[model samples]
Target chain A: MSELEQRGVPEETRTEIMEATFRAVSEHGYAGLRMRDIGEEMEKTRQIIHYHYDGKYDLLANFLEYIIEQYEGSVEVERDVPPCEELDIRIRQCLFGPGFEEFDHWERMKVYHELFTHAQNDERHREIFDEHHRRLRDSITQVVAEGIERGDFRDTDPERTAQLITDVIHAARERKLSLGHDDAPEEAVQAIDEFVVDSLIVDE
Target chain B: MSELEQRGVPEETRTEIMEATFRAVSEHGYAGLRMRDIGEEMEKTRQIIHYHYDGKYDLLANFLEYIIEQYEGSVEVERDVPPCEELDIRIRQCLFGPGFEEFDHWERMKVYHELFTHAQNDERHREIFDEHHRRLRDSITQVVAEGIERGDFRDTDPERTAQLITDVIHAARERKLSLGHDDAPEEAVQAIDEFVVDSLIVDE
Candidate 1:
């Protein structure tokens, strides 16, 4: 439905280039990212990368969108799945999932943090990051609302509860990435599980 | 007494330079920050900034340490005060205190986020960031343990409870900075207050 969806296979090359950019960024940082480094990562000419993107900024903007899409696609709260279970899966994914385990996951998160940090000063980039936040919040809100409706969760403020969960998960992720915390994910899972059980679950 | 404290009032110039760097990064962002822009912000010759620090990277690393020290010095949980009240004050500081309301607050947070994102690949920067995280966590943990000991709060695992509080607060700050959420601070205060009451308060 999106332009990205319509492009299909051609988008694969775009994604490949984005991944290469990600590697360069992970190794050298956003400030240090260079076309030559990206080209070296991709084993292609800078011209080829330039053909796909105007410059580093342009490539990074698209890369931001691409990773957002990839993340959104990875976590699905299915209709048949109990909302509580779905919430667990989502939280676990945020903390201990393969995404957290893999270097690529951490790398992508670092770049995402870079975009977020940059968004504070760049109006154009702010819009992209804002949309990403909206989508992420909406997805979590849906799960919270469904859990309440299914009678799995207590009758509480869905939006506030969802926001709380998001805040905790995000804090954990940020600390882990920036502080080189190996235990953050597990600690997050334990903390969230306890918080949810105490604050959100309906008493039998 | 750290090197910074040892410098005393003579450090006013150091703080001035750091503030100038903050303004430059706040406007142009970390990646775009240049010595010329920093000098222009301070209305000082580039030679002055260069004389104090070797390069942009050196200036930024020192700037990171400066801000971290600044933040650590902001909040204090007094021994004679009721632990619950101390906890309340600390949470409010994280959420809606004047510290969070000032433009300088947002600017500093943005710059701190920049360092965090950059620390992913830079080991030296990572050590600075790691120390910052540890100190923040320890501060929160002390408040939680005191609250529990004084029976101003429920008996709970203080470390885990502290981590939960940190996660939610951090997430709220991150989202506010990146997504342009004007309401995040207030929302965070509400969410965290309610979570504490429900999860940790002992019904008297």
Candidate 2:
């Protein structure tokens, strides 16, 4: 069990709070968000939220971990999926994000990036973001390594290639959500296909 | 003269205010920054800052344009430089950022990304960020097109390639500054060299 899970908030209640936090952040933004705002999104009273989490800062710190966990847990593929296909799915998932019942992909990403930007000034938040980056890069590296071992991809530096692909996916999302560049994400996928992915595949 | 220039603030004083804003934002962050904080960073009093700009929001809105202007003006290469060299210099400048006397590149980028995040909620700030993104991508596109015309680059889609390169540079900076992934920027440069730049160059 994760450290956060061990803190005694039940898994279902925690998921509810995370979803409410997402809604609140979507409406109010990171700087302006309040516990009351999150409470309003939830069916429960604000006292319930305060009972579980200490305050706005504490809740947000936990919210950061919660959202990252959601993303980490959301990515699932068939066991029989090939490495090349798996890599493509993972890249697309990062770029487009997974489907959520309450919010669209970009909506969740908007809140995610807001929290991400806040990490610059907050040490705890920065640590969380650093861990997420490391995990993401490492996961992509693993896939690339598997592809190479399977004779499906050209032999290249998997770590560097993963870093490159991860950065591009991140930048494309930032462009789409932050700058309102509607075409940026699709264009990024195409570029990755032509440049990064094509360069990875070996001749049949 | 630009609309901002025509608003009656002298060019030199505007630059000073912009620099002060950068320092204040760097110190206090976007959410915590105040007019007095900016005044403290400047030689002038708080009233001088108040006299020129309406409030913290207005000052920051202008500061967004000011830093973008600084970056736009800072990219200077000799007219005789070839397109490929110019492209390399521009990419490096974006990834590493141009040297500033007051603060280093990442310091400036930290503040820039802070304001960039604020743009998600503010319409005016969003417009400024949008304009900056458009200009950065277009400049890179122009360089790529020139390189192709000169036969220095292969026949690839210049617009798409430029967008890919620009996004990677942005992501690299964000990773380095926000996540404290110190190696991200240099690693991005390496990946671009092998994947993007080498792919651009025509075979001997």
- Cα TM-score per model: 0.89, 0.96
The window of 10 residues in a row where model 2 chain A has the poorest summed lDDT is A27-36
Model 1, A11-40: lDDT tens digits are 668767877877887777776678888888
Query: What digit string (tens of lDDT, one per residue) describes model 2 on residues B68-181?
Result: 888988988778688888888888888777888979888889988988877877899999888888899899999889999989999999999988988899888888878888
Poorest stretch of ten by lDDT in candidate 1 chain A: A95-104
Candidate 2: regions farther than 4 A off:
none
Residue A22's lDDT within candidate 1 is 77
Report, for every candidate in turn, its global Cα lDDT versus the true structure: 0.75, 0.87
Native contact recovery (fnat) for each candidate is 0.86, 0.86
